[model samples]
Target: MSDFDIKSFLTTLTQRAGVYRMYAADDELLYVGKAKNLKNRVSSYFRARGLNAKTVALVSHIHHIEVTVTASEAEALLLEQTLIKQHRPQYNILLKDDKSYPYLHLSDHNYPLLAYRRGKKRKSGRYFGPYPNATAVRESLNYLQRLFLLRNCEDSYFNHRSRPCLQYEIKRCSAPCVGHISQQGYDDSVRQATLFLQGKAAELLRELQQTMMAASEALEFERAAALRDQIELLRQIQEKQFVDSGQGEADVWAMTDWQNVLCIHRLVFRQGRLLASKNYYPRNPAGDDDTELLAGFIAQFYLADHAQEGVPKEVVAELPAETMEPITEALRLSIGRRVSHSRGQRGQNRKWLVMAQENARTGAQAQVSGRQESARKLEEVKQLLHLSDAPARIECFDISHAQGEATYASCVVYGAEGLMKDRYRRFSIRDVAAGDDYAALEQATRRHLTRLKEQDDLPGLLLIDGGKGQVARVAEVLEELAISTVALFGISKGETRKSGWEFLWEAGAATPIMPEAHNEGFRLLQWVRDEAHRFAITGHRKARAKSRSQSDLESLEGVGPKRRKELLLYFGSLRNMRGAPKEELEKVPGISKKLAEQIFIQLHGE
Candidate 1:
């Protein structure tokens, strides 16, 4: 147990609140901990006798220790969770949160954009739900499209529309791009949609009634009919809303542990209605008691801000008696607000806890079975693809371009957990033919394959975006690199250019090999391919935007990044820049009359 030096590391431990990590002799992480006093808490392991069996066992393997100081205990709790997630320390209870729920985001604009998001909420907009399933979010979005007719296209797509697209033709959108809907009309629809999301059906219905009556009174029978239809839809939706009494917002948490497996179910309520439930499997959460686990999870969960829409005002949980008050106080300090952490041991709260517990038990068993199934499928992939071993790391590549402009390539990695985002990379095509997809892929492979020259880090499977031709190029690149063990393949869009129907190819193979459509191997390949396309498209869009903006601004003398930004901010857009009067340009604070004239002449191409 004394395999490495732990005594010297303990000498440097600070007295301030922070998190500490202990590593075993093999550099394997043993545990992660947060303490109000690092020196006191950490030293207790080596200095204090009569330690708990778990701490005693963990300290014996602790060949190394690392500490990170924080401003407060609350910050330390967050940092501890983050480190646990990254390292998956054997002696720590880590939350195994794989999926993030989707939210329906309504953009703040003259004509709002409706879309689905599952990442960090960085944009300022109206967001609803951490919906349990993506299908639910999509369903809600579809219903909103039918009732409100808000635009659901990207800003770039919206900006380029010369006329209404299929969404407008099908009556799902008001065609704001073509001026088919007035600003006031679109604004009203956005307001109504917001009210619907907020679960204010009664108020929204009353407002709709007034609007409908006024439309009828003004002899606008068509508009009145439309309003009447919307009202009927709202009533139907109101009937489906959940019945709950938590004063609009509350989060319910309950847990179940079978043997050494632990699962926690979190049911979130917004506007007095159930929005979604999330299940977590904290990594190796076997050693701790229920109270310690609950306290640690509460400190990490609420403070993490992992879910959208911010923290709820109330958290109802089936907590061990000893941990309730301290957990509540910790949450208060973390959020700087009086957040209620109620023990769901009685009344409606108890019922909520019961439901969550039942779900937790079921979910934990299901999660275990799912991991087993995924492992089996990976083995199947190895045999099916004729690989040397089960592929643990699969890398997929794709190239995106608009005709012959703004070429970009993306490399997305798929590991056992699916979509290893941290390993994904994007490459900009320089001095290459944008239309030549094969050459673009070759460049991407050469760049990526060169970096993974080490024996272990190179992917077991190499997936290219296109068929036959792309496969040949990848094979050529792999040959040039003098690497041969990696299994290279390409996925081609079939005759219909659809998902499910895509063709697969092995390196240098002219004929396509077909895996059954329902096979897990096929589905996994499709998932990686689709994700690669998505990544490539996003990078391509950004590259094109940057190139256009830079070329336009850099064409002018003395107009660098800062001045270009200032002019763009003042005028709002390139269109506005072209239209501004010379006098107005001169009044832009930094622009002299001579410079303004030059700007006008350059913009107008005089």
Candidate 2:
């Protein structure tokens, strides 16, 4: 149906495994996919027969296709996931969940505390178990506290404690805060807990048993009883967890569809114990069958950067052996080890597989029930905004900076489904005076609108994260660009400077529009504005950090690499150089008196 020149394109396609992207006439991304053979997989979409309804619909809009060759199918899979996350093409199945997995963090302290942590790992400590979810991390922390009695209190709280707290009375903590447990004794407990978390439970249990025996032989009855109780708890955990001596680590996956809603359930197993379970509902616009969907999910799941630390030794699924071969090969290429694939025909593997399958079915049914809520909310947004038709797309802009430096403008996109992260963009504010938000907004809007005008793809509504002044500035840009199809509005914090008390300024209006706090449309606007603010802040922080990390002398005129090296060597460090007077700077090789004075004035603001 599309004038894509499929025959000409196929002739030039390669047979190697790689990634392919489809685009519409307007240059909008339609889909991104990986294939074992680029030539064959892409050809399937254009065949005369056997094409599904959704695939045909996608092909009908295809203007052209682009391909990137990779060394292996595994590499292609990784690249495919990265592009999908970045662009989120219309014809591809998109996984909405993006939060990082949680971990059990052990602080680097004399008496360390085991705590649940998420996000970037910047703290100095040992991190273990990038568990499936926060609940798994918390449950593990509770078990460790019960068995080892390690402190879970914050360092500040521990430092200021005057006496044993309620946790000590309840027997969950040994009250390291009150010196009830010696540093050496707490260190031993920490070691045992670490061992258990590292999946060396048998080794830890044996060590605990030996310690208990020694205590009993030394006539330390109380110490022996405590050790014995710990051993019993460990044994109970082993039994209840269904510990299998043979299996070290594995993941079981099951996918099911109910009323066109698809769900994938995953069960993670580490050290023969079930760690946690997760459910994913990806939007499948092309209507891929079970095998294709399962394979895609596997590639995206295991190849993600967050998942690299937790790749298992095996995977259990119901997919055909042929379908799993490439997946196994790709995973091996990614993790530097051969990860076997199992059909889960019998024994414990089969049982885990069955559980995952049932969970997937249940999750799909639940998703079907909740599908209408999103539509209802969208309708409410339409009524609140007084739009004749529900908007297909909404874009918001926000500006962020530290004082007058490292300014960044962020544009976030929201569509019918929700936040469209792939469509988000950040513009570094340049040529404008630092901290001049009006000029920054004008520049960013001019650039963004110029591009949209070329592509003929403009959003229905444009929102600004500021008061009427900001909206007027952007409106001027729109007028300059001769674009008027988009409706413009601005959001500003109310006098209280709190959420749910925000004022909105419609374009060309002298006053702000105050919507009720509980209005769904107002809440949607709040969500988009907050997202834009967050994105801008993140970009600004990264730019600020990078600017700070660079040498201060780089910004000075007439300072090249050779001059910088000479200056550093003469002064030994930047700190010493900054302290140098103009006379002292003049003594450095190739440093003229005038240049030294200039450098001194710039560095010291003298």
Candidate 3:
């Protein structure tokens, strides 16, 4: 633990009311909190009397503390939520969820129909369930269309129907837009569909069964069979329900708080089937109680889901009754549901809440472990490279060519966890001779150093794939660019062209420093050196292939683009074109006798 000034840091806080954040030396966010009296709450950290274990530990890492004065406690809470999502402070309760939830998109055409989609609202269609998974939502949609006999065809197809399509003949669609069914009958089907999505499955099923029995007594066999099918479809839909609370389409979300972290898991039910589940971990969560944190996550989580019409009919949480009403109304308006929150602790309803909580715990633990592992690997790399600080950013350069022909260079980057491919670059040699290794190296070094000078962010290390020569060239380039601070090294293969045995080049040294056998430094240099070589060789191969293709064409005389392209397409390459006899040359579409002779002479040198 470093010496942190607790009293000095706490003096700025006010009991009046505000939000505050604590940060570590590396700028990692430690925690975010809001209090009625900002000064009083913040002062607790500096107490001569013992503080809670969590507070004591957090205070030890406090190099800097920042604050924002809010007008009221509610304002502070809102700002705190925004910061938690943004910073993901380590010591705060985090809600980890990133998957896009499914939504039922209701098209805004004259006939307004239902469809399933996910993501930000792009078109003017009402979207629903970012269902638990695509499978459940898809099956529900199929059954709904079957039971309601609503048309599934697009508006374009609906408009062009002079006669009924197969959907009508098969009894799956009423075809209202094409006049196959009366407006009143179509409206009834639409109403039934809307009710099913609203979670009134029992009512819809009961009505369909009654209709079927009534039709049978009248001896209308054809109509009776159709009604029976609709009833069966409704029953099938009901069978897929994992937990039916006698309520309709809705989402049940639960959260678990542990080790100052929060995990929020949600299950989406649409058309009586559990459609999908999503888990979110928001960093730096805080509340007066567990219920408050859950309430905060729901509000922030659903606001994004609402615009897409994915809001549920009911939301069940372990939170107290006081917080449920506003959350329910907010969600209800988003997806047009009469949203309700349940607090039943002793039934099948209670089991759903527990299951959701379990999922949250498992998800949060896994995410935290992954983050720790990444951090450890980064630490390992830093120690091995003898870096003054952690190498959060690395730059590797390599040269590629075939005996110096088509020589090109590639620069690649890696940081904290792995490679940053977006920052990778490839350069064509501009001032280097073919087959001249030193000259090609010089050209690449100069261009890369010049660009690095103009860029704001610079790499922590400059890795070259050759021995002392390569390292010295890069150092010279850096010096010329007026940049003298970069840590430069060149890695060259040993006598047998095998790895593990390498030469390390540094500035002002006549010889490279070769590490002892099985040393950590050797392993570190090998990793970076191999990475640079791979990048350079890949670039060189591509350049060489392109040059070989165009050069063959360049050597041919009296052949323009049109004729040369004809020759290439006809014979494939110069070797094939030269092998072709007089008759084969005559068969080419654009080839004249003189032009063919010229090509033959260029190829055969006859």
Highest lDDT, which number? Answer: 2
* Better lDDT candidate (1, 3): 1
Ranked by TM-score, the better of candidates 1 and 3 is 1
**lDDT for position 368 in model 1:** 32
lDDT of 2 by residue, 1-606 (tens): 565556545643556566688889997989988887888999999899998999989999988666654434543554566567657887888876567878888999888888888778978899986764444356557767899998889877989999999999999999988789888988988888888888887687668767877998999989878876776566434332222223558888999865445788887777765444557888777768788988888888887754633888989999888998988898888779999989999766875686678557655543432324335655766787677777678899999999989999999987654556668999999998988999999999999999999999999889999998999999999999999788888999989999889998888888888999867778778878988998898788667767878646676667778989767545545665664434457656789877987887666532
Give the Å shift of residue 190 in candidate 3: 32
> Which stretches of candidate 1 lie above 4 Å from their native place?
1-271, 275-374, 454-456, 550-606
471-586: candidate 3 lDDT, tens digit per residue: 77677778877786677777788888876677777776887677764554455456655766777776675566577785756646577888876665454456555544443465
Worst 10 residues of 3 by lDDT: 365-374
- Candidate 3 residue 532 Cα shift, in angstroms, is 2.9
lDDT (tens digit, per residue) of candidate 1 on 1-606: 774434434432446566677777786879988887787898788866788998889877877565544434543554565456656878887655667767889888778898888867877788887665454456557878989999999888999989899998888999999999899989988988888888886688778777877998999999888887776555434442122333457788887764235787787767654544556878642667776786788668766877565688878886754676776677688778877777887655655665567557655544433334446656767877877799888899999998868899999986655446678999988888659988888998998899898534798899988888889988999999999878998988889976678888987676898877656677677777888998887777666757778655566766777778657545545665664445456545578877987887676543
User: Which is the winner by lDDT between candidate 1 and candidate 2?
Assistant: 2
Would you list the rank order by TM-score, best first?
1, 2, 3
Clashes of each: 3, 0, 36
lDDT ranking from best candidate downward = 2, 1, 3
